[model samples]
Target: MQPVVHLAVGYLCYAAYTRLHHGREPADLPALVAVFAAGLADLIDKPLDAAGVVPVGRTIGHSLLFVIPLVLLVWIVASRRDRRLLGVAFAIGYLSHVATDIPWHVFSGDFDELGFLLWPVTEMPAYTGVKPLGTVAGIEITTLWLEAVILVAAVACWWMDGRPGVGLFRPSHRA
Candidate 1:
């Protein structure tokens, strides 16, 4: 899945969770936190892979192994901080990204490609295959169309939800 899709899905998940659990929309901080969480893995994975420090793009950050410790750590700290929902939002966003990727590879008939999900426990061969869209220097029509559809869906969903705004650049004054 692309970054925009991941972000949209993550935000949507958080919004749904909030609406169901709290009977209201999410606040700015948690919503932004979820969006950042969704794209966080890619921020780490892409850099390391491009630098040749990792054999595969989906190594550490994209693994269940990675999620376990981080989630536990966040849980402990957030519980102590009395911010448990923030932790849940983080996990939800992060896991949403992972979840989206799995079905994509599976649907694309790349079952063996999912071995990278195990990271260190599973040795991932260096991926020499052409990327879905190489870079901004060139564009792939298929990926462009897919991204366009996702962008529209994400915007539509957000709009339907009254456009929950996550004021990431502003401070939250919650008690």
Candidate 2:
């Protein structure tokens, strides 16, 4: 999935979680953290692959082996700090990212694409092609439309949720 889609889905997940669990819009810090966590896998893996430090773009960071432990550590630390919701938000975002990357292949019965989830225990399939970045020629029109729809939904939900995270960017009123 595209970064924007990942972020949108992450926010949607966070919004749903907060609404279901707390009966309100998502809080600012958790919302921001969830969005950042949504991109964290690509941020870790893409740079490593680009630098030739890793053989594939979806290996280590995309692995359940890595993410589960990392998220558990985050949860442990956050819980100790009395901020367990932040850990839950991170889990929602990061896990949703991993889920989005795999579901297309899973739904299509292309199990080979799922080997990355196990990392060293099961190698990632070789990169088939360069992922399209802002290019129409390399992307299917349906995917572009889907991404647009998801982004619009996310924006609409955020608006309806009263734009929870925006307050973090405003200048403080403290004298």
Number of the top candidate by TM-score? Answer: 2
Candidate 1 is scored at a TM of: 0.80
Regions more than 4 Å wrong, model 1: 125-147, 160-162, 165-175
Cα lDDT listed for each candidate: 0.77, 0.86
| Distance from true location, Cα of 102 in model 2, Å | 1.4
The estimated TM-scores of all candidates read 0.80, 0.88
Q: Quantify how close model 2 is to the true structure by its C-alpha RMSD in Å.
A: 4.0
lDDT tens digits, residue span 14-58, model 1:
888998999987777778778888898888899998999987788
Model 1 residue 86 lDDT?
80
- Kindly give the stretch of ten consecutive residues in candidate 2 with the minimal lDDT sum: 127-136
**Clash pairs of candidate 1?**
none
* C-alpha lDDT of candidate 2 relative to the true structure: 0.86
Best by lDDT: 2
